[model samples]
Target chain A: MMKIVLGSLEKLDFRATVENIRVVESVEQLSKKNNEEITYFLTETEENINAVVRNQEHVYIPATSLLASHQSIGLHIYFDLESYPFYQKVKEMISKEDKPKGVFRFRRTVQHNRNHSLLTGDLYTLSSLLGKPQDIRVKQTDLSVTPSHTIILMNFGGGTMAHIEYTVSDRERIELEWSGIKKIIEFDSDQMVSIQSTRKPTQPLAYSVDAILASARKVDQELIDRLNDFSRLINGGVYS
Target chain B: MKIGIMSFAHMHAYSYANGLTRLPDVELVGIFDDDIDRGKEAAETYHTTHYSDQAGFLALDMDAVIICSENNRHKEMVMHAAKAKKHILCEKPIATNLADAQEMIQACKDHHVILQIAYPVRFSSPIQQLKEMIDNDELGEIIAFRTTNRGQNPGGWFIDEDQSGGGAVLDHTVHMVDIMRWYLNEEIAEVEAIVDSYFHEIDIDDAGLLTFEFANGVVASHDASWSRFTEYPSWGDATIEVIGTKQTVKVDAFQEHLRMFTNEKKSLEYVFWGNDMDFGLIQDFVNCVKEGREPSITGYDGLKSLEVSLAGYESSKLNKTVHL
Candidate 1:
């Protein structure tokens, strides 16, 4: 059985995803869920995680970024844009194929605001898609505003490092870029991921939603598999 | 403006030197380090002269010196620079202890030198904007704060208690505490802390959580830990959430970058692309020197921040709340 405990009850689309899955609004109702049931939380606090853990319910954390983890993750969503085509081109470049050689580094700085939880959630999702990081470092550079900014540095070992700057600003937009020893990648959320390699003077292939979505699906499957293994372990059975 | 970097012990000296060289009106006079090899290499990299003797470097007729020495050595360097009547821009926590910090401040005061404490976050564009909003009452009256300044354990002298004074609590706590003081314009009254060396085999504490009570009734919590793993992104973070009576504001000072996942590296990397806080801070220091004005961030600011960290240590030792 699958159940969702949403902080709000207004979202109806989520209820239709699975037929046998139950949906609830409060933590009280979610805690009463059977041990065999899988529960997804839309928004949960440390206190809530503790409560669920104590209740012994099989909890699957979907929003990994929001909750503070061993690794630092950050995300920011901006809605303002001047040109759609330009944005599309940028997005395509970020999701491009001819990947940069050597260590890849990424960072984002936003204006301070009150949406840190959401930004963290987005980072968590992105990190999940990337793969498990070997090491994680998070620094809170400044925190005098509502959406306090943090610099999350992740080293995936074997020379892969990521530096993210989470910013909260009045302006709404997205920008992405990658810098390597011999290559550079740049993209916007709606644009293509573009790769510029020194060795390959010619333009490299770009990536779009189709590619990113596939990766996202893969991450989702991995999470589910891990959760299943965890359930099996708790039930005193080995995962098959 | 003429500036000489005192040491190359801190990695930030590289970035600061780059910033110094970029200014049209400023000249990076030279670099001095007790370790001649490191100093010579850094000077060569930045295209500046390297001085082996401390006295020789102090007598170079520079208007100011940037001290990037180890934390414990700050007092001695500051004293030497101040005696030479050179203005100083010293790295954070001014000194390891209150006595040392006070002595450094006094030395600078006696010599009539500008002692600017390096609090680069104050110069960050986003942070500056947020400071303005708070000043304008955009967030109304502030109620509380949840701040974190976490980074990966920087081994070597940073982990050595004698050189660094303490570990995460001393190295990380002051940065966020300084910001809190700047935002609230208040001082910490009482402190409670839990410090431990849970992650590494360090003798000093590597992780800490501190709760502070301000005189103005604003309570704040700080997680100053070197809890980040080696593979974690960036160096670390300094994040703050200001909960006000009207609304809450979150500030992530280092959140300007691009995200890249490459198969070649087989890992995700975040490439930061934000206004350089170090550049702005150096610019401010240069401007203050040229204009003969006090830097916005002074030695007193460093002292106040250091006090909180010191209090945190005391609180942890006593296993109870410590009053300032």
Candidate 2:
């Protein structure tokens, strides 16, 4: 049984969300550290059964998209779902294979001098249509030696495009747009963060939840590799 | 002047009939339709006599006949009307085959009658403005064209290959190609296309993405499809994006609409309040008949567009770009 530990207060709400889950064997209390860094995803490791998410600062999400709960076929943990402000109603999504047309707007807030990163929600949303990032870019601000803002743009071919802007703020918020629907997800506070679905910001689409999650995870790993290069350039150390 | 309609099989017949009503100089003498119920209904709607026999309808004292039959039947209807010495306004894609289109053109000439093809897009205000821009050198020398003609699948004879000649590609490609040729005064030289039945479960192709080069070395891309879902705000769209040396202009022919969100059948609706293109077409045909002049859109214009559209299908079948 792969054991995932949610930070501090989510023990009850996590159970409530995945109460009908059948694939998950058990949940155990892992280490509870109070590190308010990034509130996103960590993929399940093959050997390490215990995964720790630091503090009320972040929610521990296994590599999965938001619509996975509706699909019930994959191993997914429902957490921080109600916290997002837009596209909370996943049931009303159009599930057909609609090759998304038009531009994508992706926004993420980082506390550090975080230039740019694709947030988990839009990562899944985009990765569904654009399998692997054919291209990933971080615009050079040149405003300061340690610039605090980052803008990233990705092209999925056939005019399907996405742009992500990372602005350094004290809090965490993420936004993404597909077609006419814009999905914005963020924390109301540092305590219990509930991810909301736009059912803002959208008429949700039922992309292959697990497939999109897997795709998003692959893309995230690529971004991390790119960020690692940035870390070496700035701090001369690998970014955690 | 008195005018008559040959068939009500094509939906445009109703609009053309209404155009006849809007004109003070013309009178709709009668209507003839092979489909008896359709003929009777249209006759009642337009307040005209229904003539079941094609010969009897041709014998009426009408100066012209608007042929709105199926694609395959257009040749026969136009022939009969031309022999009767009635100036003809035939629905587009002239005929199912080039030979038939040639024969229709010959028949009109032999009978000394005007043979006009109903290509209403030219009459659209935006299309006219684009032509004006080109004439005035406002956009400099024309470079390229990107156009889309997508409509909701008018299921029925439109989807039947036997009656309609082809599907969305054939139904839509002709209109845009006609306009493009008129604008550039160039013939299509090459065609490469990807055609498939993506929108509907039917066997006929409902989508076609076509790319071709005009004689003047100008490349053009056309997206023709019946992929618009039922709940879509508007019926469909015909948009042209013209790339010029000085400026690039994009015009959505049906963009003059009010977006309304109400609880009436559809949650979102686009009520179009644009200029009536059909009326313009009918008016032009009437002027040609009275003045004894060739129409702005003639049978050859229809034939050339049909040739390019058919070449797209040939390219798809051969899986290689075909030269015309």
Candidate 3:
């Protein structure tokens, strides 16, 4: 399970039998890492599209590297028709014998002028298959006098990574940036009031046919049939 | 058919009048209010005949009379509409009390007239979308919900307990509760609330924090307050966030535009200014009247929400939970 980073490939993880490793400058030196056996890597390349179409088995795309590649090479994300091989890997990591769990102190505070008030406070569950250090703490803090502020403290088994801080004076024009960490994928909250980074250990998944079918199992068959019909209508963009 | 507005005291009365004019089938017949000056002024501006007396106004033979009178006067106005055999469009919290609301509903029912409560959010497109999403389980089984129904403290009749029923909890709580019941299509089994009068220095509670437990183990909390100040330039704001096992779905019932920003700090940009949902509601009322169908937010629906508000108030008073 690799955490996708937006900019650099500092903390990308690729767990596979690293068949062979060689620091090569050219295509000829890239031969050892090339074989029928596929290996996942935390690096992006310019030849990804052609490499995949040619079925170059040894070449691998890192999850963290995809965002940049997508932007640079116009690598658009579509429905994963053929479930990527990474799903099995993630599932295995999730069910592994030695898993680490930690708790995060989630606190949301709103500050206006000299007044600071706590909006929400809770403890959250955090489990990781990634290697854990002796002590890992993830948290957010700021001193700027803003109308509101949200702080999340992730007590991870590994080192802490805090990425984003946002403030709204007028709530119309927003300014966003990343510090302490760069590469991350953020999802919009349901209210569109906030954008939150997906918690570690979970990958971003939008609704699709598989989810629809899975949930529809105990539901009414007539409703299932209607939903199935709807899926087709939406995907095909044809009413009938 | 020619339509006539009876009062301009409540803000909703203007919305209803505007909605009526938007329909091709109805025309503005006349306008009247107990306050002669305000009634005459609105009539002149909206271009409708100004009636001096309540009796004279009803004599216009209008198809309906939308009772947007003061909250306390709802019963009298509704009874008058029922007696006139006109279809009734009553502003919600239907009459400040269950007995009055029930009587109004019965009066309309007995007279064979449509009693449509003006819970305009029921007619919103986003709310309809939220309904579809929940029905499809786009959000898995809903575990909890947090709702905010806030507006500027328009004190007058609204703050006066005798006039506006009880205050913010009474005037504002019904809309969100009705929305909750409508969205879940289920009855709330129990309610616990902490209601207070924090915003305005009033004797009655102007804010309510209520937690509702549905029969299906779904828990929800509502924030109904008259805390929006005039400096904000917003009359009211309503939003609901529903959390489920797998996902969350929210409806910004009051606004439309969504914008995002991040610089020295990140923030969201939300503005709900452009569209008019009131027209949709009134249009539905007209369509229902013509087609002989029940209004989307019916009298029964209004009663159910009022019941929840009443229960919440009772819960707060008793300092204990109430079983609905």
Q: Estimate how well candidate 2 is docked, as a DockQ score.
A: 0.03
- The regions of model 3 sitting more than 4 angstroms off are A1-240, B258-271
* Cα lDDT tens digits for candidate 2, B1-324: 999999999999999999999999899999999799999999999999999999999999999999999999999999999989999999998998899999999999999999999999999999999999988888776656767787788998988899999999999999999988988899999887756675567879787767777777666767787767777788888978676656657788899999999987779989999999999999999999999997899899989999999998998787666899
TM-score top scorer: 2
Error of 1 at B135 (Å): 0.6
- Between candidates 1 and 3, name the one with more favorable DockQ: 1
Could you give me the TM-score of model 3 versus the true structure? 0.58
* Model 1 C-alpha lDDT per residue in residues B1-324, reported as the tens digit of each score: 889999989878988998898899999999999899999999899888999899999999789999999999999999999999999999987999999999999999999999999989888787788788899999888766777787778898998888889998898888888888999999999887656665567799876667777887676767677766655556667888786655667787877877777775436766788899999999999999999998899999999999999988887677666888
**Window of ten residues with lowest summed lDDT in model 1 chain A:** A74-83
Better of 1 and 3 by lDDT: 1
